[model samples]
Target: MTGPAQNALYAALFGDPQTEALFSAQAELAAMARVEAALAVAQSQLGVIPADAGPAIAAACTALPIDPQDLTQATAQNGVPVPGLIAAIRDRMGRTPHAAHLHWGATSQDIMDSALALRIGPILALWEGRLHAILTRLAGLAADHADLPMAARTYGQAATPTGFGAVVAGWGWPLLDQVQAMPALRDRVLRVSLSGAAGTLSAMGPQGPAVRQAMARALDLGDPERSWHSDRSGPGHLADWIAGLAAALGKLAEDLLLMTQSGIGTVVIAGGGASSTMPQKRNPVGPSAMVALARHAMGLAATFRAAGLHRQQRDGAAWFTEWLTLPPLCIAGGALLRTADDVLERLTPDAGAMARDLQIGQGTIHAEALTFALTEHTALDRATAAARVADLCAQALREGRDLTELARGAWPGPDWPALIRARSLGQAPQEARAFDRAVRAASGGLDQGGS
Candidate 1:
């Protein structure tokens, strides 16, 4: 029997190429290269090695080619890349004792951490692009449907009337806020880890600081004041950020799922599934996928958070869990963004149904505003006007008359006609427009950054 087909991600991360080339996998490899070079350079500068050897070490480290399969096999046996990588470099450099300076003051965690930062740089770029596309699509949908009226649901029951734009805006604003915070969050994830052996660079003497600074410059990462060998705050914070993004998408997906329900029939989309069993059913594919993707994201995010609870020095179990968690989280987020873009792009507004549902509550949806308007022309207080409107609604329900006619006869208010006519909407359009502008502006900035 054949084994399962290899996934692209697995091949990229574990393949035999000198470079992984894929964003996440390459990050780990790049970090390793940078740390190795920096350690050699630091040793030469501090007079621990021949000055001429520094340039040779840097050149060899960058250009050296090793069998990826060999590294993989070594990792499987020893659970780390340093052992195999060291052997490969020694082989390339021959039997010269100078090769000993290749990894002079560094440890396994240093290279691994650097690799993680390299991976984050590219992953963040991908995430930013997905976010911009999703936000831009949502803005367009909101703008096009700004004045389109729809039922406002509270607790799964129709409570009032609102515009479709407002509903979309509610989802867009919070997501935009998250986009604005991404750069800082990325910085937190890009910090460099350079402490050797234990939490201190004691093996490198006083030159550790200069070497660390040079390493940070070479890799475009920040240097923490000291080693964070056991502190998992950076990884934990990143996990939380990802989880928050998933939650936002999940909320949007939940709304689309409900709005597209057959019973509600408030929202319509093109190219949804046609049931195989029943030839007549048009399934809401976009919303359904959105819901599924969001759920998957939530589960992976939970795993990422759980992986942060490792005890000091580094728990292999918890650290290894990240290998399982981060990739799925990234993939799920990408899928959700893609699905949301498709869903919003093809969404069709049902103006007639929205108008009809507004009257389902016996015009109670418009009653609150009408009551406030009536108080201006009559001696009755705000509460009295509200009571009068309630009475008219009850009578209309019993007598089968329009609320507008009942209000005119029973309340004798001058503004009753205009107030009743304006009841089918609220602040939804204005909110949608404002949200659209914000989303476009944010997306513009992200696009400028090539996200």
Candidate 2:
């Protein structure tokens, strides 16, 4: 309850249940046990332990009834849960001949890190599912509103006209890149760690590398070939990926936050939060939470990266820092993705309000279109045409008239509506549909390790 992610009051708002469960103490213990079992079997297969010991150790690891609560005091004393875990497993084996072979030549870091890698496989799988759902929803949004015109803003002011589809696509391209990078990321980060003690398997002598490879194959993980005891790059890469995903989702949330403002209500979010004091308030709760979670991820990512500064062969301080930072960082990322998917599911674009805002500044949004038409169809140069349009825009604002009308009065030969339409949403529709196509093509590969 001390952690906001698991706190009863805040869990629904900020926590991701699946992510929490994966990183939970019980889950960690199970993963560690799995690692131990794999290590035992691998050692036995490589002749480092007795042939009969492997199955016995594996069975014990699977069937041992070691509660996580029983390991807390030991974990606090030993700086890791593996010692207590192995002890509990050995005790459960009860002086059996194979009990001595359990966790042989393996350090606590080996079990712990390998267990984390095991858990990461399912976590990545979860992310793949979420990404597929999110991209599908976003593609639908883009296709549905491919030509729906809206005022595009820059620097907190309306700049020009754009389609809502393009705006949605902007939020999707980064995520698509993330999806594409999943395979490489998994290869880089989801590797087995089997460095014994000071990263050299001295106890197992020459068969150590073989044992490590066997364990990696048994656990369906990548083998780094060298010990990563002092190399924290794997975890660092994961933190970076999580932060990047959060930032991408945050960008969408920030745009939605602006679009849903009181007077500039271009996007309507259904099921907005009700303000207790205000009778007419529909606060953007999901976007707000996404933004907050994204910012939290940013800070946690920095700390996580710093934890990569491990000293020499092993640094308990840096390792402990990672334990403190990674779980919450991962949870925040999951919540952000979950919230973004939910928000996109309920989002509705207000065409009427968008139209109102498009013409809010006396049709000045079309000034760029007017300037381009003046240059293309007329004799004026680019600078001259731009200046002339600027004058017309000022006149339109001063006289409270439409810039289009004034521009047409000055230059009548060009087809105004056709010209404006051609220039306003130049590549927005195409861009949106391109994203839709990309997502569709990648859909089949998303679950298969991003191909």
Summarize candidate 1's per-residue lDDT along 1-451 as a digit string, tens digits: 0111125553322121211233343345545766677767767876767786777777777856765666888888877877788777778778777787888778887888777777767766766776777788878878999998787888887766788888888888878877888878876788888888887888878878777877777778888868876777787777777677777877887887787777676778888788889987888876776676677767877888888787877777887787667666666666566667767778877887777777775666667667877776678899888888888878877887777777778766475768645745767789999999998777777667724
Off by over 4 Å in 1: 1-27, 42-49, 63-68, 387-402, 412-417, 421-424, 447-451
Model 1 per-residue lDDT at 96: 73
Give residue 105's error in model 1 in angstroms.
1.8
Cα deviation of 63, candidate 1, in Å? 6.0
Top candidate on TM-score is 2
How does each model score on lDDT? 0.73, 0.90
133 in model 2: Cα distance from truth in Å? 0.4
